[model samples]
Target: MESPIYLDNNATTPLAAEVVDAMAEAMRAGYANPASQHEAGRRARRVVEAARERIVELLGGQTGGRQPDRLIFTSGGTEANNLAMFGLARMAEDRYDGPHHLIASPVEHPSVARAADALACENWQVDHLEVDAQGVVELASLENLITDRTRLVTTMWGNNETGVLQPVAPLASLAASRGAMLHTDAVQAVGKIDVHFGNSQASSLAFTAHKFHGPLGIGGLLVRGDTQLAPQLFGGFQQAGLRPGTESVVLVAGLRTALELWHTERSARLQHLTSLRDRFEQQICAELPCAQVVAAGAERLPHTSNIAFRGVDRQALFLALDMAEVACSTGSACASGSSEPSGVLLAMGCSDEVVRGSLRFSFGAQTTPPEVAEAARRISKACKHLERQKHR
Candidate 1:
């Protein structure tokens, strides 16, 4: 059997061998419940603390001072995002008076945007910030949207679909000046870019392990020590009562190992992926003159490229690539099953035709030059076939 090329790392990555080994070892011997008082429990607690330390270090957070000890591990990126949005929104309600509002970019993952919508249903005002054609947040419009009633301003550090990196630092600073807490969903940004909780003004950030070559079903919300976010779950005092449940020592250990590896080799890995992405795009453009690279000049992540082919159905191209043994995506994996155009593209001022014709290809550590070249070849061929079929 031939090795299938994977260009969908933004959707999820294969678990690293180191991560699997660490997880297996943890499951074999670190089975004690961390909440118990026995020696085994102490051992489990130590492992959890050590994993937390590694994660904090990877995120470049200070170990001491008013640093964040409020790391709440959740099911995944979606849950972490929900916890950050709902938890902070509730806290704002309890602490402040009058109508509470939230400001978020329209290009945000549905986890954050949908949670804000749910909050809005409960009478909270939710204002969605629009992104420009380049997929960056319109910073000028942000100042006008932030008013006294705005409790939180939630935006993604990197868009999952277009891989467009937002001006999070400036947005965070703006939120802080307006007396509003800022939360950024950094799920796509954590391993691909440098994230510093100690230095960043964002009150909270969310990340998932799978995005970083770690095991799935594990992620966390990084809440600043001074942030007054309320717990969304009600139960035991696990994760300082912010996220309650029996901790998955195996998953946590795997995540820490993955994070450690990423921290050590981030620069080299980024350069490699960037080269692969650029090469892929160049080949695509050379082969298909009608293709348009979405947000071509924007500051996108090193691994991602979203391209639009004129008069070609993205779904057809997606399945064609899959059948050709090259795995890619139509847009965000979360919305892959849907036939509708990508909200991210639509929000970035892309025409309906562009939205319907877009495909997202993301690279990762396991991706190779040959794989990218082959994938681009397959895509060009598929586009030709699609065009011929349309003409028929």
Candidate 2:
């Protein structure tokens, strides 16, 4: 059987060899629980702390300055987001801020959006900022929605589906002016783009390791030193009690190695991905004349391309590509099994037909020109077949 051409990096990525080797070494030599006081445990603790330092350096955190001591490790992006929203929301509520409210974009990942909705069930006001046709949050609407009672503004740094970068700096500034904390879900942007948590206006930021060729089940939240958010968990004082558990030294080591690799090779990798993405889209447009590339004019991530076929069902196209040994996504992988159209597309004012027919193709380090060319050819052939069947 032939190997599948993978174009779904946004969903997850293959582990880098270096990361895998690091994890293997940790599992063999640093398996002790980081919380224990024995010498072996101290060795494990040292490993975890070193990994933290590497990640902090990658994110531009200072060694002695007012950097956040609140690096909380979690299972993944979902948990990080939940910790931020729930912890901050409860903090605001305890302060008696007129039923403290939270604001987020309508197109946020389900992790953030659902957490906000759950908070609303407890009488917290949750408002959604609308996005424009370019899939960007309208800054004016966000400003208009803010009130004296607003306690937090949570938005994503990079959209998982469309890979459209949000205007986080302006939003962070707006939140600061109102004395409301800002949180950005940077899970998709961490290793893929330059993320300077120290310089950013956001009070807290979240990121996962697997999105950048690291091991799964390891992620962290970056909190500013002066942030007032409280811990969500109670136990040993590990991770400042914000996330309490024996740390996974193996996964943390893997994440550190991945970040190191990214720092060393980011510029060259980005240029390569950009060239491949452009070639892939150009080939698709040349072959399928009726296809529309979504957000083509926007400053999208170098690896992602969302396109729509006028009359073809995206699910059918997805299966057809699968049959051709090519892997892609209809939209966010979290929404993969659902029949509903993407909320991101809807927020961009895309018509229902376009939403249902849209497909997302994301490239990564392992994606080669030959694979991209083959995937495009297969997609073009599959789409043509679907169109013919529709007319039959």
Candidate 3:
């Protein structure tokens, strides 16, 4: 059996060897609960704290004249995002004396979108900022949506599906000017792009290790020291009770290693992924003239490409590609196994036909030129075959 060409790095990345080693070593040497007071527990606590410092440094959270940000470890990006959205909203409700209004971009991940919807159901005014045709958030609409009642503006730093970079800094600045706190779902952007939480101006940001070649089941939410999140889980004194749980020293160690690798090799890895992505797009376009590159005019992540194969069924294309031993996705993995069209493309004003036929291909640091060539060939073949079957 041949190895499948994995092009779905946006969903998750294969663990780096160094990260795996770090996690394994931590598991062997530090198995005590980090909350305990014994020697073994102290070792575990040290591992967790060291990991936090590494991630803080990676995000530029430690700077002059300001205390280092607080990083609350969670199960993954979903939990981190939920803690940011719901936690921040709850904090706003406690401190303020008006209607609690929260805003999010239309193309946000399900975690943020659904959290906003939940808040709306609870009598909180929730607004979804509109986006332009390129999937970029409309600045004017954002400004128009902000009112005296708005307390939080939650936006994603980078879109998971289309890979289009959001104008988070300006958005954060706007929210700050309006006395609204800003939070960003930086899950897909943290390691793939240059993400400086200090400069982002967001009160809180979320990221997962799996998105950057670390272990699963571990991620962090970095909150500015001045920002407060009402405790979501309460049982222990861990993470200041915001996310109280037994810290997983092994996973945290892996996450730290992953961040270190990304911080060290970001430039070279970005260049490699960009070359693969560009070549893949050029070759695929040549193979299928009717295919449209989603958000072609927008600044996008170097590793991601979302393309629409006109007049072809996306599910059928996906199936055909799978048969060719190539792995990709129609959109966000959170929306996988659903028959619905991509919400991201729909939010971009793409026609139903285009949305139905779009697919996301994301490369990673380990993806090579040969893999890119093969993926393009397999995708072209699958699209052509699927188009013929559709006509038949």
* Tens digits of lDDT, candidate 1, 246-347: 998898898899899898999899899889989999999999987999999899989889999977888888888888888889977887898987889888
Query: What TM-score does candidate 2 get on C-alpha atoms?
Result: 0.97
- Badly placed stretches (over 4 Å) of model 1 are 1-3, 66-69
Where does candidate 3 have its weakest 10-residue lDDT segment? 60-69
What TM-score, over all chains together, does every model reach? 0.97, 0.97, 0.97
Give lDDT tens digits, candidate 2, residues 215-266. Answer: 8999888777787677777887888677888888888888899989988999
Q: lDDT tens string, model 3, 1-392?
A: 65699999999999999998988888778479989999988877887887787788789786335666888999999999999988998889899986788888989999999988899998998888999999999888889999988999988998999889999889999999999999999999988889998899999999999999998999999998788889878898998788888988888889999999999999998898888888999999999987889998999989899999988888888988888999999888998989888888988899877898899999999899999998888888888877787778
Q: Rate the local accuracy (lDDT) of all candidates.
A: 0.88, 0.87, 0.89
- The superposed Cα distance between candidate 1 and the true structure at residue 345, in angstroms, equals 1.0
Positional deviation of 217 in candidate 1, in angstroms? 0.7
Error of 2 at 74 (Å): 1.1
Query: Candidate 1 — worst ten consecutive residues by lDDT sum?
Result: 61-70
Candidate 2: C-alpha lDDT: 0.87
Q: Better model by lDDT, 1 or 2? A: 1
Among all windows of 10 consecutive residues in model 2, the one with the lowest summed lDDT is 61-70
Please count the clashing residue pairs in each candidate, in the order shown.
0, 0, 0
